[model samples]
Target: MDKFSDMTLFVSIVKNQGLAAAGRELGLSPATVTARLQALEDRYSVKLLNRSTRHISLTDAGAMYHQACLEIIDSVQETENLLQTGTKEVRGSLKISAPRDIGKQFISPLISEFADQYPDVVPYLYLNDNLSNLAESGLDIVIRYGELADSNLISRKLASSRRVLCASPDYLARKGTPITPQDLAHHDCLTMVRSNEELKTWHFQDSEQHNVITVVPKRCSDDGEVIRQWALDGAGIALKSILDVQEDIKQQRLVTLLNGYMKNFNASTSATGADLNVIYMSRQYQPKRIRLFVDYLIERFQQL
Candidate 1:
């Protein structure tokens, strides 16, 4: 039996979740896939999977072996890609995930420009604020903001955007502009919500002081774009990324408030890191397509 071939087949079976599905992916019949799996188990003298009529699951030993197989397969593929000349002419499907507001306003244009430069490469963009499963979703990279909760993934800083406290001129005219962090108690603040829960706490900081203020939410949404729209519509004050609201501030549509107290607040509703980042799983070798895309993003975002 070819152990490497079986390892590839086994990993595909797990990812695809069935023998027939794995067979379809590998261009083999279900019988052939089953035969190869049996050969692998026999060679090792241990059952690697628990199979029923309708489904299959990995055994404890199978889970451990699958991780080792992934590393080995990745190394071999990297070696093969390294031997291929003309890495400069990148060509392949590149899948990426990014936040909705940034993705539409910034990343979509970047992808279009990159595609124009490298017409041979295809791009797929998935927009969501939720953290994605990279390996399971087969994503090449994810552009994230603020602190990452998952420590297993690799992250690189792309750029940083300062946080700002701002309100529309109309709203400030109606409710009065706040001059200090403590004055937020009297204003209606448009808050950000995640998973149906409103994030009511806002953090502010200066050289000598740090203040945490809990405000009543006038409106809230899981989408950052929605919250931004609310602020633009003169709903109430909001803490927002300078990148997202820079044009509005420049146009005087929104007035930045409590500037003296916002030096270190970092725009995140929670006091987490607010640097924009591009993240991916640690790999033995990154494909040229993925590497080129990352470099292109860094170049474009640095200009912003």
Candidate 2:
């Protein structure tokens, strides 16, 4: 292996604490990893690691070398990122993440349109309901609801959004539409279970009344898309983001319930993370591809 590749392997070995584990991570066989490490140590003429049957520990020299390796690796990555700033040519991979429902219903078409305009730029879009770390996940942008607490990340509001209680026409016809938040107690409700806790309690506000009601969910799911599908299938009433069900409501597939008594929280609600936002890592320079895509997304959402 080359010097830089050896440095990378040494760092991985130290991080993973075993030759076999680092081999598995880097897609190298155990024998190859061992040979590479031996070659690296010979080139340095130093015993870099103390090895046992089950684990490896860095020698004093290895510790010093490990820190230098980290710096070099980070510098190389930063230099590559800096290269994007010099070119007006927008051609690279744009990795994006979004909630499943919004991704399917809105972001997917927007990405398709963007791709057509910039055919040289590759799009890698994945639909996920939970938050993903941009830097760790190597994601260029994440479109999600709710406010972010991380100071190292920058977020821009794409649109103001809120959840609403709605049910399919058939479900309402069978169970009857609720006129007040309390009426949900007597109705079968579909709720989300996130992080092992059910989001069964819903909040409402009106001109003269504010209420919080916790309904016993008749159907529970961790997937927002599943809950939406259940609501559409006439299984039960569902509290969903309007963004996820607006077209359904407009098509009269699902009807809004408790219009006078329930005020679904908006994107800025501190009580919940249900706002539409596009988030990226705070960087000294963003690639032209990412900047253009973010601007494009913001403009499109504004017209909504």
Candidate 3:
């Protein structure tokens, strides 16, 4: 038996959760599915599954092998699709998730442009502050900001987004600009609260020295947009991502503060990490739709 075919069949059986179901999907009988599985196992001299009459589960080795099989299958499919068309023909749905502020301000319009370019590709975007599991939520990509943790997911840096401390001119006129990070404690800070936790602390770096300071905020909000708006209305000083406040800074509606004492602190809770990123599960056999979307985003962000 062809090992790749056997691997695909085995994957199908695992996905379907039964030989009978897998057989139905592949147009093979249950006996044939069992025989193929046995042939594969015997060839490897290992038990791939722990099977009961009614259910089955992968052994530890089987789990590892299954992951490899998936990667192999995806690569094959990608190669076949490319060779068959002899051109990049993108068609399929791309499900994506991103932070609310960045998604609304940047990603949304870019996605619209992508749609115009690849009309055959359908896009589904979810914008929220909460992070969702890529596999469980069935997302094709997640565009996020900040330093990323080490994980199985693949992450590519699209751009560097820095967090800026700013307040409206009127707010500064009334309260005066903070001369140092410590002065934030004396000012009426606008804080962002998420997951029921108030983020009252900000970190700063000077040379090789690190300073973490806590502030007292008169205004607290769960929505980042709300905090940004409050800062615009002269409520208090707020920390915001450059992407969200770039236009405001350019227009001089908001004046950046503490530039000298500022640290490139990325406190964003997005799973993909602090710096702007295009995160996905695997790129081995990424579909045309996803590939093009990722490329478009990278290009657009670079221009930004």
Candidate 4:
């Protein structure tokens, strides 16, 4: 039991990056955490961590030991989870991130229903338009606008949606719709800005040829919702995801443009699998609540 406690302490320190933070998280005092870590090192007769005044890092041996400890802890937790949760209620904290428009329009309502069904499961949703690193954000899921190339993560398509050019009917009526991709250079365009860079370049392809046009944007923002609202306000034409503006088009508030040309909504030259995806880490084990919630999201999105 002492050895197991030491292993837990070591992992906590590494994860928290300090003895004091680990102690706070684990409900222990800083001195207790320091003593337990020192005792583990003394028992092994080798230093596992290189600690500075403000930071801590694992030695090579400590890195290997941490990996082993993780495996052991995961196995034990799996066994305990299986024993305690046999045909029982699924309950856990589910942390998710998404774009602001989608979160408020779709995910937020579904989350309300989902929470009513599983009252014990807590949900946390972070809404921002800019792309985020799921691992660095400590979020369980990230809903993004496109597919990712990382093998460590899984990007699952939630809806069959594509990017299209659209703008408010009033804007198009005044600006007199662009005839070709080249004409966009002369028209007012709303674009997205990410990482302090303006995404003003647009890509279009038809069976005949591929074309790239760099439009001078009249307005730009980090939030897609802002750009969408601007386009609705007759600020300029916008290249947007179909799922986002479908209702607006149906209501005749916005009109789809350049139907003959398929515009690539991605910022880059290449296209990703989908315009929107629900991404999570690819792991051997996932909590039942997360699995159920993801499945529920898939089911609800399919209804759209």
Candidate 5:
């Protein structure tokens, strides 16, 4: 029955969500995948999946067996890697996820260089503004900014950037600059809406003291790039990472506002600052490809 082959096919089908998709991944026809799965089921005297034209769902026993298959596959891969690469270089695909803007501007270039150095390894870069679950998504690493909420994932800080409150010179000139956190209510402040219902509130601290204040914005957006663009076009003031606005600020396209009130706070809205982190699931950390990619990222960030 080629038990290991059947198990691999089953796991791939579960991960891909359908026989056709799994078959495509394995370079087999959908009928072949179905036949193999049916064979495995008959041999075990148990149904592993609830199959339909549109979707496939796992039975309770199938779920347990699937997990065991994953562990077995990982162990076998580890053994092969250890025996084949005694002193050889790391070689495998590295899947990474990061925020869209930062990934395009910062991480992509680093990855390009890494790929050049490790020609045998392929990189799968997934860029999105939304947070992705590393374990579920099968990503080797995830780069995130701000404070992390998932304690189960291991994180290593790569770099730091402060959030700055600023506006276009034209906007400040026409609408008078704010001098205090409370004065933001009187200004046309641009807000970032991260999700369907959650808007990013501007947080601030006293320049000389530890007092903090949270201010709601009069204008909002789901895209940080959109808000930054609006800020450049003299639409409203925005609180954004220094990395995004540094070039414009240097060119005098934008002007800093309420300098005395823009203070560091906490993970949610602290003005104090945020650190960019490289995170991964604990179980995959020992893999050669994972370890090499992480070290490469750390080294690149250090140079930056």
Candidate 6:
């Protein structure tokens, strides 16, 4: 008898509580089911099931083996599903949400590439600085930076970037570089206001001690790009992501300040640190388009 077939019969017997019931469900005779189970036991040289007039139960080893068999069966089914649906032409609308800066700088290009690869897939990309609920927003996926608060959404880490304190070379030359967190009070801090009610607070570490300092901004705006541009134009010092300002720093357009004191800040404010993640909802089964897009994003981010 096939080993897999015998294992299936054994599992069905346990689930149905008897060989007769399992045989009825499987459209086989009770004697055939019993024979299959006995063959499996003989192959393993262990008695798997304890039979009684009124009840059936598994031995200790049988329970462990049953769980393993179930997992293997599940994996086989999943693999078959992937093979059958993997190359099916993905034609559908996919809605994605991301923060404004990341959306424009990174996600937009990814979407364009994804659309080109699967021409039938239409993408609706929403870019906003404000927090938007994925389910309520009707999004297929959300690219979030930093910590997330929702426990229901499934998140996959894509990449990581550090938030660093930066200023233009000219601004630093005029104001002088701050060596300590305390010196930020004397500097012209350019703050990025997230929302109407949000306050801009900067975090730093000194001698392994952490501090959260609220800066009285010399210039403030809700737009991150605006503050970043202002810093580039030598208006004031701004805290920004390393990835966002990497080229500028490389070109000496902007210079990092208070390097020893700078630490990662949680952009979402719910957590203490930041991580770039791709979040999606749990379903009975994920569609091909959703899986493909997420895999593509992860691959692209990993390459970066």
lDDT of 1 by residue, 105-197 (tens): 999999999999889789999887776655544567899777776665788878786678888999988999887888988998888776666
Error of 4 at 169 (Å): 1.4
lDDT of 3 by residue, 1-304 (tens): 6889888898888877788988999999999999999988888899998899998788868766776776677567667767989865676678888877888888989999999988878899888655555533446789876664638678888877667899999999998888888888889888887678887888876655667888887999877778889999999998887778889999999999988644443433343334778888754556667777888899998998
Q: Which digits, one per residue and each the tens of the lDDT, describe model 4 over residues 154-220?
A: 8777887678899888998788889899989888999898889998878887768878898998998
Q: What root-mean-square deviation over C-alphas does model 6 reach?
A: 14.6
Model 5 steric clash pairs: 264-271, 264-272, 265-270, 265-271, 265-272, 266-270
TM-scores, each model vs. reference: 0.74, 0.73, 0.70, 0.78, 0.74, 0.67
What lDDT is reached at residue 31 by model 4?
Answer: 93
**lDDT (CA) for every model shown?**
0.79, 0.81, 0.79, 0.80, 0.75, 0.76
As a whole number from 0 to 100, the lDDT of residue 174 in candidate 3 is 93
Clashing residue pairs found in predicted model 4: none
- Model 1 accuracy (lDDT, Cα): 0.79
Runs of candidate 1 exceeding 4 Å displacement: 1-89, 148-151, 263-272
- Across 178-269, the per-residue lDDT of candidate 6 in tens digits comes to 87877888898888666574345777766667878777788887666777899999998888877677888999999987777646543233
Q: Report RMSD for candidate 2.
A: 6.8
What number of clashing residue pairs does each candidate have, in the order they appear? 0, 3, 7, 0, 6, 0
TM-score of 3: 0.70
- Report the backbone clash tally of model 4: 0
Ranking by TM-score: 4, 1, 5, 2, 3, 6
Worst 10 residues of 4 by lDDT: 265-274
